[model samples]
Target: MAWYYVENNESVGPVQESDLHALSQQGKITAQTMVCRQGDTAWVPFAQAFAPGSAAVAVADPAGAPRVSHSCVMCQKSVTADDAVQLSGNWVCATCKPLYLQKLKEGATISGVRRYAGFWIRVGAKIIDSLILMMVTIPFQFIATALIPGANDPKAIGAVIALAVVTNGFNILSNLAYQVFFLGKYAATPGKMVCKIKVIRSNGAAVTYGRATGRYFAEILSGLTLGIGYLMVAFDEEKRGLHDRICDTRVIYKD
Candidate 1:
């Protein structure tokens, strides 16, 4: 039977079974990307539809559903009648199996435990960090103003300008130091710590200060993209922003 797959929310297919397998092997199809056969009512994962002993190959009831409760280890979508595959002793839903298999094929071990931090959680962390930094910077500004309430005299004007420059410089250095130190040493700032997330490399190692600094600057690119770069964290499988992608890093929940 011919198979079809969803890509970017668009349906694509009617290709032969062999062609679908070829696409899976080629990494063109992921486990989480939905797919289905010609006779299937609901689209399933490409892996689920084609893996050995897949539910797609199973004899379903007259109603066309899985014969048992099978949950996908990745996406967690369950199906009663759709064919589910067993991989590494876990019932992987068709939607998540392809990616799992692909990871194995690529020599990447699947722990199946890394939980990516969603966008809202990251936003909450950012808000907390902003509040903390504001507490630090705001007082300095107030002191600068109190030092030279009215710049009526030349000395007062000079003092105010010098203080302004110093204030700005202090702000820059402190912010940089805050990120570089925490990310390098702890892989997270206080805010991220409060939110229970940390930054890590693709291999799950702590990021170096150099990488963290680079990621900090890459945040500028994310900002430059009209915030679309930051928004990418919402849709990405790895919960990566533009900066995270640039640095080959991911923000995930801490165990």
Candidate 2:
């Protein structure tokens, strides 16, 4: 029987069983290393694949049938061939197929696995960001109010309107700057950093300044949708919000 193992995130060649054991003894292969037999469509931990009486190995059934189990690449769960779908040479179980297809549609690099941030956690991060922005904008609000003339003075109406416009414009620019700076440079805002989540391109590349700015503006659509866009994260297979979908971005946990 021939076996393969994952090394440095790449699948290594098919070796004989004795060679696999030798590699294990040399510390080149560990129990947690993913391995699969040549005929198997699923990859499993080395320990599970070779453990005594492990079900991962094919066995002869009393009914003269072969019972072979495969592992889902997305969830790492054992499943029969009939229960899994092969995509891009990887086996994904039915439960993970929808999400996998979504990733594929978005051109996301589906290597190994990913843990996406859920709705409540994202909401918490948004709350933190809102509080921080409030702290920043409140002082500006006070200054703007003080600069405006009394409402009773009809002559000052034009000045008040001008002041209001300038203040609002400044607020918008500042907010845009904040988002663009953090997301472009670090791939996360302070709130997302606190939550241990980061935004990245669907292709698993780093976010650029232009993409970050566009994403900041795209959030307006999310807000305009009466928050249905935000709520989509709860039901989305990859936990993507409307802005994420529009910008082809994904929020995932840090390694």
Candidate 3:
């Protein structure tokens, strides 16, 4: 039998069973080390492969390194080596370990390093979204205007004001609802979905409806700044506009 293990975030090859035992003896493999054999669908902990009675796998830190606790890079909780998980050279306590593992299972890195969306991609998505919004809102507007008997009559000024107010109010509320619903539920608007982009927190968690709504409003700041805030996406490394930064959200390319 041969086994492979993950080291420094890279998979190290299929060593023979004897080599596995040798590596175990050399303190190179630990209980937390992820191991897999040929034809295995997923990795397993080294300790699980050889249970206590079947065969004792020496997974202890035999190097004489102190058993003292270290702070978890994620939750900042103190954890001993036995309850700590190492990923990309950082220690994460058991309390925060499952989140990273789940991310890995979802094909995202534990550190949440994703290829961020650039300015032009985001702009195109916005354009598509705007067109969709127009398609939804414009028809109702035209119908309302046509149904009004004196819409173009000079003497019907009051009716014209009422219609304008109703149309603008409907547009505002509908747009708000559309944005909040999609961004919160799917982390992307229909247009963003088409563009293969999603909105996520810096930690790679889904953005809640409250945060999504706030992010939408914060976009006003981008316009208030004469579009400089929006253009920040072009210049910033993460391609975040001012609104994204203010809301602690990132727009990224989802695989």
Candidate 4:
């Protein structure tokens, strides 16, 4: 008996040869019916291919219309109807699609539950680190003012330039160094280390620099509006900090 494999709105003939005969004998298929074979990329039938619940077809649509949806690639969340968010060539649920893409753009790993440092501790450490950075920056700012000639003119441009050269750079560097060195080595920042907390990737891996930046920026968004955003963490399923959802990151327990 000749067999056919159903694939991509089309049918190709002579699949496994034996599989078709077996299906035919079992009454699971008929000459005018459509079915699929094992080890085949898709389902095919004597007439057309049918996905999981579309079996008892009453009409000969012949087009093998795809009325159902596939699961999401990242969260594996199912999407049934047409209104679902389609991302990365798969059907992703509404709540997860935006989040998943946010992380992907930032290159976050986003795998499983992870440990995170307490909010207060992180805030405090950033303060101390920023202070130290300021100390290092003031001297450099004076040097820059003398070197740039117009750097002292407080017209916003020069001031902004001076700030970027001195304070802003140092501040950013300080935070980067603090998070990367601490989190990479101990899975915690100085504050997190002191607070006995740590940040972890969703998959139990050490948080990477890229993901850390995403989460940190998300923190900025969460804090820009009177801290109402941070409160969203308490309501989240994984207890995500504002940064977690945006970064596709999470904080979990070390022990």
The TM-score measured for candidate 3 stands at 0.56
Regions of candidate 1 where Cα sits further than 4 Å from its true position? 1-112, 147-164
Order of candidate numbers by TM-score, starting with the best: 3, 2, 1, 4
Candidate 3 residue lDDT tens string, 1-255: 777777766667668878887888898988767776643424567777776665434344323222345567666665655568766435677777888667658976444336689999999999999999999799989988888767767789987887888789889888889899999999999999999999998767799999989987899789899999999999886788999999998899876
TM-score of each prediction: 0.53, 0.56, 0.56, 0.44
Q: Per-residue CA lDDT of candidate 2, range 1-255, in tens?
A: 888778877667679999999999999999977787765656777888889887785333312123356578778887656668877445789999999999979977676755688999888888887788878787877777676765335678887677778778878887898889999999998999999989998757899999999998888889899999989989888888999999999998786
For all candidates, the clash counts are 8, 0, 0, 12
How well is each residue in 199-237 modelled by candidate 4, as lDDT tens digits?
A: 765544577777776666677788886886677655665
**What lDDT would candidate 1 get against the real structure?**
0.76
**Against the unseen true structure, what C-alpha lDDT does each candidate score?**
0.76, 0.80, 0.78, 0.58
* RMSD to native, candidate 3: 13.2
Cα miss at 174, model 4 (Å)?
A: 3.6
Residue 122 CA error for candidate 4 (Å)?
Answer: 4.2
RMSD list, candidates in order = 13.6, 13.3, 13.2, 13.0
Deviating ranges (above 4 Å) for candidate 3: 1-112
